[model samples]
Target: MRVAIVTESFLPALNGVTTSVCKVLESLRAQGHDALVIAPGTSPWSPTMTPEHYAGFPVHSVTSVPVRQFRVGLPSYEIETVLHRFRPDVMHVASPFVLGVRGLTAARALGIPSVAIYQTDMPSYIRQHSGPAGDLTARAAWRWIRRIHQQADLTLAPSSAALQDLAAHDVPRIAQWGRGVDSDLFHPARRTDPGTAALRARLAPRGETLLGYVGRLAPEKELHRLVELARVPGTRLVLVGEGPSSEMLAASLPGAVFLGRREGEDLARAYAAFDVFVHTGTRETFGQTIQEAAAAGLPVVAPARGGPLDLVEVGVTGDLFDPDRPGDLAAKVAPLVGPEAAELRERMGLAARDRVVTRSWPALVEQLLDHYALAIRDFSRSVA
Candidate 1:
C-alpha cells in the first residue's frame, strides 16, 4: 500500500515520534511498498546541511515551531496537492496535531483510509504548562483533537491505557498500535564497551548506585521529583537528554550528572551503564525510553500509571510504585540498594531483556499492515 505519513516531528530532532516514523518508513521500503513523509525539518536544503533521506524514500520537509526545545511542523498548505499525486491507499498520521490534523482532513476529502496515532498526552501537558487556568485550554484542545480524530477511519493509540483514555473522552474507532525497540542497537552486549565503564564512573563517583532517566527534561515528565531519588542515599541520578528544563533541573538537582543527550552507541552505553532505570512521567502514551532501557538489561522502576503500566512487568521486568503515594518510588527501589542488590539486579535485568524479545520493528510493522488492511476494508465497506 502507498502510505502518506504527515508527522508533527521528524529528523534533526530526536524523540519517540521521530524514531517511530523512521522505523515504519524503513519497514515500508523493505516490504516494497511506497511511502512518503511530510514533516518539519531544520533546513536540509540549507548551505550547511547535507540532505536527510530515510531508507531511500523522499521527505517533504516543511516549516514548524519549537516544542520542548524541538521543532514540530505545522501542516503544510500543499499537503492536499501532495496527497492528490501520491493517491495513497492509506494515510498514517503520527501524533495528530498540526500536520496530522490537515492530513486527516485531506484523507477524508480524498476518500482514503486514514489512521491517526494518538501518541502525546497533550491534555495533561497543557495543564502542566498552563497551571490552574490551563484546564480550559486542555479541554478545548481535547475537543479539537477529538474532532480531528473522529474524521479518521481509525485512531491508533500506543497502549491499552491510552486507548482507555481516548475512549473515555468519546473518541471512537480506538485501537492499540504499540511501539517497538531496536534490540541489536540497545542490548546487554553493548554494556561491555569501555565507554560504558567510563560513563558509569563519570556519572556516579565513589561507587554510588547509578540510576538513569532518559527522555526530554520537561515539566510534564515530572523530573523535579528526581531530586527525591537523588536524596536516596548513595544513588546518583544521571539524565540523558536536553530540554528547556535543563538549567533549572541542574540547579535543583545539584551534583546529579546531566549528560545532555546521547545518541547511537553512546545512548545504549548510557542505558546499560545504569544500575536501575527510573521513569517519572505519568502521562506517557508509550514510553520509548523505557523499552530501550529494558533492552539494555536495566530493570525499570516506574510509576503505576500510563504507558509504564503496560510495558513494565512488576517484580519480574521491573517494579511499579504508585506515584500518588508519597515515598512509594523510594520504597520500590530500596531493595536494589540493599544487601541482596546483586541478586535482585541480575534477576530483574535478565527478565527485563527477555520480556521485550518479540518487540522487534519488523514484527510491529507487520502488525501495522494488518491494521491498515482492516481499516481499509472497514472504510471501504462504510463508504460503499
Candidate 2:
C-alpha cells in the first residue's frame, strides 16, 4: 500500500507527533508499504537540521514559519501537487491544524480517502497559552478542529479522552488508536546496566528515591505542580527534555536534576534509573512518555485525566491523582516513594511493564492500516 503522511511537526521537532510519525513510517517500511512524508521545513532555530528523508521515504517539506521554539507548516499548492503525483492509497493527516487542513482538502479534491489522526489537545493548549482570551480562543480552536476532522473520511484518536473530546465537538467518523512503546529499548534490565546505575547514583547520591518526569519543560505541562513533589522527604526529582519553560521550571523546582533532551539509549537509561515516573501534565491527548516509563519498569504517577487514564491501571500498575486538587499529586506520589515502599513500587513497576510489553510499534501500525482500509471503504461508499 502507498500512504502519504501530512504532519504538523516532523524531524528536528522532538514531540509526540514527530515520534509517532517516525514509528509509523518505520513500521510501514518494514511491512513493504510505500510511504512519503509532507511536513514543515526546519525551524529557524535549526535551519540546516531537518532531514530530506526518513525511514527510506522521501520527505517533502513545505514552507513554514516559526511559532515559539517550533515551526508551523503553511497551506500550499504543494500538498495537492505531491498527493497528485504520489497517488497514495490513503492520506494520513497527523494532528490536523493548518498543514493538516490543507492535506485533508487536497485529499478530498483528488477523491482520495484520508484518516485524520487526533493527537494534540489544541483546545486545552489554546486555553493554556492564549492568556485572558484563552476561553474564547479555546472555543474557536474547538470549532476549527471540528471542521478539520469532519473533512476526513475517518479520524483516529490516540486515547479514549481524545475520542470523547472529538465526539463532544461533533467531529464525525471517529475511532480510537493508541501509541506504542519500544519494550526492547525501555526494559527492566536497563535498571541494572552499569551506565544507568551510575546515572541513578549521580542523581540520588544520598540514597534518595529517584522520581522522574520526561518530556518538554513547558507551561502547558504544569511542571510547577511538581514543587510539592520535589519537596517530598527521601525523594529526588529528575527532569528530562527541554523547552521554552526550562529556566523558569529549574528556578521553581529548586534541587530537581534536569537532564535536558535525551534520545535512544540515553533516554532509555534515564527512564530505567527512575524509581517512579511522575507526569504533571493534565491536558495530554495521549501520554506517550507514560508508556515509555512503564515499559522501562517504573510505577507511574500521573494526573487522573486524559490519556493516562487509559495507560495507568491505578493501584495495580501505578497511581493517578486528581488534577483539580493541587495537593493530590503529592499524595499520589507518596505511596511510590521512600525505602519502606520499595517492595510495593517493585511490584507495581513489574505490572506496569507487563501492561505495555505487547504494545509494539508494528502492532499499532497494523491497527492504523486497518483504519486506513475502513476509511477507503467509507469514502468509496460515499461516492457510489
Candidate 3:
C-alpha cells in the first residue's frame, strides 16, 4: 500500500506527533509499503538542520512561518502536486491543523480516502496559552478541530477520553487507536545496567526515592504541580526534558534534578533509574511517556484524567490523583515512595510492565492499517 502522511510537526521537532509518525513510517517500510512525509520546513527550533528523508522515505518540506517557538506549515499548492504524483492509496493526516486541513482538501479533490489522527488536545492548549481570551479562543479552536475531522473519511483518537471528546463535539466516524511502546528499548532489566545504576545513584545520593517526569518542560504540561511532590519527604523529582518553560520550572522546582533531553538508550536509562513515573499534565490526549515508563517497569502517578485513565490500572499498576484537588498529587505519590514501600513499588512496577509488554509498534501499526482499510471502504461507499 502507498501512504502519504501529512503532519503538523516532524523530523527536528521532538514531540508526540513526530515520534508516532516516525514509528508508522518505519513500520510501513518494514511491511514493504511505500510512504512519504509532508511537514513544515526548517524552523527556529532547528533552523540549521532538517532531514530530506527519514526511515528510507522521502520527506518533503513545505514553506512555513514561525508561530511563537514552533513553525506552522502554510497551505501550499505543493500538497496537491505531491499527491497527484505519488497517487497514494490513502492519506494519513496527523494532528490536523493548518497543514492537515490542506492535506484533507487535496485528498478530497483527488478522490482519495484520508484518515485524520487526533493526537493533541488543542482546546485545552489554547486555554493554557491564550491568556484572558482563553475560554473564547479554546471554543474557536474546537470549532476548527471539528471542521477538520468532520471532513476526513475516518478520525482516529488515541484514548477513550479523546474519543468521547470528539463524539461530544459532533465529529463523525471516530475510532480509538492508542500509541505503542518499545518494550525492548525500555525494559525492566535496564534498572540494573551499570550506566543506569550509576546515574540513579547520582540523582538519589542519600537513597532518596526518584520520582521522574519526562516530556517538554512547557506551560501546558502543568509542571508546577510537581512542587507538592518536591516537598515530599525522602523523595527527589527528576525532570527529563527541556522546553520554553525550563528556566522557570527550574526556579520553581528547587530540589528537582533536570536532565535536559535524553533519547534512545539514554532515555531508557533515565526511565529505568526512576522508582516511580509521574506525569503532571492534565490535558494530554494520550500520555505516551506514561507508556514508556510502564514498559521500563516503573509504576506511574498521573492525573485521573485524559489518557492516564486508560493506561494506569489504579492500585494494580499505579495510582491516579485528582487534578483539581491541591496536594492530591503528593498524596497519591506518597504510597509508592520511601524504603518502607519498596516491595509494593516492585510489585506495581512489574504489573505496569506486564500491561504494556504486548503493545509493540508493529502490532499497533497493523491496527492502523485496519483503520485505513475502513476509511477506504467508507470513502468508496460515499462516492458510489
1 or 3, which is superior by lDDT? 3
Give the C-alpha lDDT of model 3: 0.93
Question: Model 3: residues >4 Å from true position, as ranges?
Answer: 43-48
User: What are the per-residue Cα lDDT tens digits for candidate 1 across 120-239?
Assistant: 999988887897789998998899889989988888998989999999899999899898899899998877889888877787668878888999987889987676776588788889
For this target, which candidate reaches the highest lDDT against the unseen true structure?
3
Q: What is the number of backbone collisions in each predicted candidate, taken in the order shown? A: 0, 0, 0
Q: 1-384 in candidate 3: lDDT tens per residue?
A: 999999999878789999999999989999999998999889546656568999999999998887866778998888999999999999999999999999999999999999999999999999988899999999999999999998899999999999999999999999999998999999989988999999998999999999999999898999989999976899999999989999998899898999998999999999999999999999999999999999999999999999999999989999999999999999999988899999999999999999999999999999999999999999999999
Candidate order (lDDT): 3, 2, 1
lDDT of 1: 0.86
Global Cα lDDT for candidate 2: 0.93
Can you give the TM-score per candidate against the true fold? 0.95, 0.98, 0.98
